[model samples]
Target: MTNTKTNYLFFTGKGGVGKTSLACATAVEMVDAGKVVLLVSTDPASNLKDVLESPVDENIKAIKGTNNLFAINIDPENSAEEYRNRVTQPLEGVASKGEIKKVREDLSGACTTEIASFDEFSRFVSGETEGTEFDVIVFDTAPTGHTLRLLELPAAWSSFTEENPEGASCLGPTSALKSGKERYHTVVNRLRDGSLTSFYIVARADKASLKEASRTSNELKELGMGNQQLYINGVFKAIDKQDSLANEIEAKGSEQLKSIPGNLNELPIRTFPLLPYNILGIDKLRSLFNPDLQKSISESTVAQTNTPHQELTGIEKLAEELCENQQHGLIMTMGKGGVGKTIAASAIAVLLAKKGHEVLLTTTDPAAHIQDFIQQLGELPATLQVERIDPKVETQRYTEKVLEHKGQGQSEEAKKLILEDLKSPCTEEVAVFHAFSKAISMAKRKFVIMDTAPTGHTLLLLDTAGSYHRDIMRNNMNAGRLRTPYMSLQDQELSKIILVSLPETTPMREAGSLQDDLKRAGIKPYAWLINQSLTLLSSITDPLLKSRASAEAEVINTIKTSYSEKTFGIPFIADTRLLPTLLGNKEKV
Candidate 1:
């Protein structure tokens, strides 16, 4: 039987879920089927070139040995520039001289960057571009939250246009929406049509990623995006039955796997075995996508073993710790990219709220899915307030205020330069730090849970504290007037850091580094939460899983020893961690 499906696939989930690898594998599969395929990555950190083992850049490049396969990384900034020109070109003739300049400035905002990228994305989805002849088009997306926002932009932009029917042209709102109506409608229609698009929530076979996928799936469904398939990647199968460590790990993994949560179980679940080799190059990806090849590889390498170890029940330990002291402070979750920091943070927030603490859950992570996760909570108690910090908005407000203080007569070029400087990563850190300070202030009254950015970003944010301190000292009297009241608070008394990690080697190592970094900055963690360990609660049966579990035990011991007893572990949950209804049945302590 011939498969006649028009493949327009989007891979999204929590960060670090192997979306890029899966997208590459799927595209390679289509290419091997003698079909033309285009793999496009919309992620800022596009690893398509790394995965394909080719030097592909912003433009489309054909993969070697694959006649029908091509890949491209869509540069959002370049797309935004082109879009700005296109929008302004027609307005030049109709708009008055002064109006044209103003329109150009308005279009230069950060929103323009987002709109431009969405426009490029829409062209592919709507089949409006020259390369629309491909039999399949796969998008290797960023994390779930950003991708969803990008997908929903057409509707948002449409609403904005409708509200201000006059185009935001130099002509002072006199420009008609009719001018852009055709293009706008085309993009909106493409996004809404399920027949033309399908999404796969790619995830690791761990509690946090699985929970995030389930939550993201529900949010997308509510947003009218079609239900997504659940692609569970990195599943470890037993290769050696005699190895106790291996068996113990697999047994634990199996327990979690068998108990697939309610929200996730209904979706078509596809499993990919854990591979010894990194899925970076195209050949490896091609091999990974081949069913027969993968099956043979999995069978040959699978190990079964069990090991003895003391386990730490994460939630129980956490509950006990929290109950011992109902002190108000901040619990910040920090980690590397794609390591489930946001989900871990959200889980902490939910648990604290359930325990009757007035909690304000917030995140400074540039790519956070906190909102999506919280929406699944379904009517949280009045004491729980979940909010997201938009760095862009904060930066914009800061920029405008500074400009107002600088006052008029600045040349357009100078103004543009100033705005660009304000949009720099450094400025973003400052803006986020200002907000962080305010949130920390609120912890004096209630529990504040922060889902911090990735390690590098968090370091930059905390560095701002020192810089602000220096700036304040330099301008003593003036500093007092400019400084926010929140900046004066000490970190130790107001905040408690929580390092979150999985049982895997990479995550644990990263978490350790995060702790060291925070400690060096004089920020000691109150506790550490090791998330999604099968070995923590059950015996493993797969050799590889057992080894992994053993490794985790070592890490856990290290954490316990190093942190002096402020470490906890949250075991893998069988069911999806979506709605309260789904997660209501608490696991036995």
Candidate 2:
């Protein structure tokens, strides 16, 4: 009933929660139902091209697999370049070269990229881009932290420009705030309208995803985006009560579902069953709503999917390696969200601390799910401390710190310009990066285990850090060389990035892409972790689950061979909180 009514749809949650698949499936469902649909992805690291099996780019083109369906990826880099060129090309004759260069610099970095994407999103939502042609527009947004910020930008900038009439902060040194404020408010209103838009907070029935979903729901509620629903993906129930792994998996989900977090319990929820195979490709996407129509998996098919590779035991060997010859260093668990980064990081932190070393466990997640693990740890006798690098808190602190120091020797006008620029949300990104640097610096004294935000937001922070490194290097070229945050991250001995992902094609590929990005930035990952692997569980279970385990063997070997020099695997143990189990299953092993 609601699908026919709402023209705008938002599928947003923590990463790896099947947002893209669900969104694409919904768009296709709508299209097959005879409504022309336009699906748009706002993720920096989108896999739309792979999922849709089409050559998708920034241009709004027809998706080949389905009729009456169109799609586009809001390529942030391209959009940022276009926006900068569009705004500055007109000033070629009007402004000096140095002035123009400075203007471009102000409009550069992740800030401008975000601004460009927001502009594109606003255009589509406000019916200015491909609106007349499509009956519905589906927005596959970035992970939770990034998407929340993107959604809040319209209201944020609108209020910023309204109260500070002459402020030129949002557009940096250049001021386009006057022209965009009305449109920004219009987009915000369009989003807030329940009749036109529907926001689906998608998540798996786990602590990390649900808590993040709850936080997102409350925040969106505060923003007056009350047209929201919870989409619980991969829900499981045990048909065979004797199967321990299956029973545990089902029980874990059932227990969590019994007590839904925050105001999420208030929202209407739509649950999807846990599928044996991932909803990959166009055919699988089309089968999402009608799973009974999907092809049956034969034993031969399962056998074909299985590989000869044996699964790595657990985090035991990996934690032991981390402790060897390294009493104090940085260990960052970076991954697509919902692939169990939170649990893996927490487990590693606990293990390290239990090994008689002081461990400072922190997270860059805006939701701060790390804080929730404190109760689960239940009085850690080992020196384990948890903290969160809150964006808002850090932004405020950075603003004051800069105002105090930068304003010391500057003239009144220079100080005011600094103050003006600090008012923009761009400053917030810098603040978060500063917090990340501080967290990295702590590694010198103790084992600093950092659980980062989902891939997109973490990449954004790192990109900001790279910009930071370049800026400092340029300014202090002739002066004494100080180690930048990026430089510290690049040092293999100083930092060990643990690339985490599930043993699946898309998640592993995304992790691989992240690893490539890190390599390009001169940061080598210390190890790779294939989390929540179903391989090695020979327990008699459902045919579907058996096939899934067989499927994991291939990806596990791929990750062990192609991804990292030091590879570790964690089995899918479904204890409360989904915490790490030393061995996958003692009896089975």
Candidate 3:
């Protein structure tokens, strides 16, 4: 039954939901069953190679052991380079060098990166894979927000091309779209055809993740990719009934499963149990396909557990430092999606607020659940307030502001074009960044804590900041105006970037990449936070839990040694129903 739907499988959801793992496991299973499989990862920050323990680069390569399995990682920058050449190669004879150079520069922006990546993946979706020989293609896509934008591109670009056939828009001349019309249309049709494609909305058994999954499911249905399934990953079920924390996590997972959204009830659902150790390498990944393999592995891992433990500094310690020093500045917690940045941010804000500091906590994350969690806490903190820099609201506000001021003397036709251009996704990034700048400006008065969007989008926002700094510097030729927002971020005394991540390889790898990106943008992170360290938990009898606890000792040690002065390890809590309690001293592990 699943074979017919195996031709094209798309695993998408919020970041850190184990989409890549599940996709790879499924592909490995198909390969073991003698079916040809091609696994393609379209995420710009892809960890496909790390997950597979093999090199999967821009060009497709065969898996080490599997004769019929192959994989590829689409490089967006390379794609943009190729895409630019395709658009400007023919103009060399007709246009001057400067003209060609300008065209290339225009194509080198974020918008072009997105379209180029889309163009590369569109070929596979359209069944235009010239060299690959495979029966099934599995796509491990980017995070939810980015994936939705990518999915919408075929129709969005198709409409723009149809309307402007010969006119130039964001991506250079409209003639560029002429050659790709049929291909884009084909990709659109193939995506909508239920028989040819299937999407599995992957999520965890938590309120925030489930809610995001439900929303994504509805949106996918709207896009006509209605043939869908749901996979609930990282479900924690207690092996020792007496273990209160494990039981609490188990009960919460069960409750969330029972309350599954009505819209998703009709779709088939699969649940994967949370493991004690990270699922890395071929043997561990293959264990996902065969449940019986888990127990033996768990037993072996638990038996090998022998690590010394020492007291680790946690968020409470950091809170003490902040309170003692009366720290007041911009506090930013950032990492890949689903890595518990929201929880970390909330904890910090709650701690500071309890210390009677005026803290304004906010987020720019699309899958934000801060308000929902705060509501669950029953009451608001007197010293703390929460707000979200909503992209849609900010974009609308920005558009109206522009129309009222810049569009004042324009003709109706000119005004209409301005409105249309404002609707582009690029405008939302700028608007959100504008809001971010405003938030940074508020740090002079009180503590400003910002929970940023996931890694990819956050990088884009920072890139916008970098570009804006260059533009303003070029125009003003003075550092006076730049001293406000631009210099504010670079000032360590005025701003602190807190990098958060799980102890697992993927999140840490991405966190390292995120740190590098921030450094490149001239923003240095003040600290590294290792969230949900099982090493901090009490002695565990359950084999799985014990094994997990043992594995975390090594990770925690690495963070402590490498970032001893600045690293903080936050233990995993059993219950998070009350934010205050969860982040309070009473619950300190």
Candidate 4:
């Protein structure tokens, strides 16, 4: 890919598949190949600066001590503010302040930020940057859901503009839409043209990430971007074949590969072996494509000795603490994608159900598989019910409710406009927020174990909660007597937030950032759960796997000291088909 002449390249897949690392490595490789390259990150939760070890912002800043390489981080918050000004600035003096305020409020959403970032993305692809000196442009996109939405917008916006010339939905006025239509259409064509663009789907050897990569593959191909390639990252290699757990890890990767989704079979596929140590700095980045370099890269990561399992609390103890002799409460497991939030929530839900508590295991993720995951246990307890707040189902329900109540007195033409406006993707936010708010209310009667969507979407839901709280305070006559969902989140007695993450460099940092965001919202996390740590394999004979666990020690200690009041670790278990044995055994705190 570094040697390809393709003008545009995009790295997208499930989160934690090493998308950022791979993208940066590609840029470095291209530069080494003497090709001037520009990299752009469209993820709202971007970590380009951390990966590059360079001070990157909205501007195209050159990497330190490097030539012919430049990068940009399209900050969504800043982009939304700029887009809001662009939209409202024109309406000034010609429109009422009340009308302008309403428009601003409408634009204050995660969806708007998505569209704004899409607009910036199109600017580069639609010939607006044709005269730039760079030879190629590479994009490191957000997780699967967000990337699909971003790619779909060009076609969505083009069709929307052509049909609804007199009206606009979140892309500013009709006049601007008319002007952007051609560019949007141009972007759609550019994406479809195989010679000009390539979409790389990065994944791990796990079923979930591979399944998502397959879905992303078909979705992007349907959007006219069929020049797709699949990269299976972090392939397991057991140094000690005699070790049972290590061989199981290697066997699982092989099994997953043999049955990879059908769609992936059609694309060009590549694989990278897993590294026991985290890759940082430009030198380690180069080691990705060079296995010889990787072997001799560092000896510091390895320890000369083995140690027994260290003393610490586990998930069983944490689950007990969450129940705390209470029947009704809200327990939220929040984290970035691929961090085992669902598993943590499930273990706790089963533990509580066995203890005679009525629990509802739910998820707000659009790509959720809560029911399937729970049903795998063969016979679920009657006390433990599983549900997923299906975004599509909730959106349809919310749309009908709106059309029935708000559209009843309007004319057919007026109703048509309202329905058209509802087609905007932003409607998903309002629909999901309604369901989220209801779930919070249900916790008052039964244990509501919510495995929330990834970090970006959860923050958006929280932002909506805060917005709704402010609206109620400003407009309601009985504000002092009312308690909103935001208030429920802030109440320590009613709600408990558990931060979840893998014991790795990126996941740990992202979890810490999430904790800070929660603190800013006055929602202190009850505890931190480091999922999939190597602590369970403390007795393993493999040197590479042991070193992996050694790296986790530093991160685990950091979480205990710097982030959470209480910390727990869920060890890596090879057999995920069966429920955890720890469920039946509660630990003493």
Q: Write the per-residue lDDT of candidate 3 for residues 225-276, one digit (tens) a residue.
A: 8889999999987888877777787888898888888887888998998986
Off by over 4 Å in 1: 1-4, 80-110, 167-179, 242-245, 295-337, 340-437, 440-449, 453-589
Judging by TM-score, tell me the better candidate of 2 and 3.
Answer: 3
- Report the Cα lDDT for residue 416, model 4: 88
Ranking by TM-score: 4, 3, 2, 1
Question: Model 4 off-target regions past 4 Å?
Answer: 91-102, 129-132, 166-179, 298-300, 303-309, 409-411, 581-589
Tell how far residue 309 is off in model 3, in angstroms. 3.1
Return whichever of 1 and 3 wins on TM-score: 3
lDDT of each: 0.66, 0.80, 0.79, 0.82
RMSD in angstroms, all models? 10.1, 3.2, 2.6, 2.4
The per-residue C-alpha lDDT of model 1 at residue 529 equals 76
- What root-mean-square deviation over C-alphas does model 2 reach? 3.2
Writing each residue's lDDT as its tens digit, candidate 4 over 507-559 gives 88888998898999999999998887776554677777887887777777788
Model 2: CA > 4 A from native: 1-3, 90-103, 130-132, 162-170, 173-179, 295-309, 403-421, 477-480, 580-589
Summarize candidate 1's per-residue lDDT along 503-577 as a digit string, tens digits: 555456557766776677566777777776656646445455555565566666766776435766666544444
Among residues 3 or more apart in sequence or in different chains, the pairs in candidate 4 whose N, CA or C atoms overlap within 3 Å are none
Off by over 4 Å in 3: 81-109, 166-170, 174-179, 320-327, 479-481, 484-486, 563-565
TM-score of each: 0.59, 0.91, 0.93, 0.94
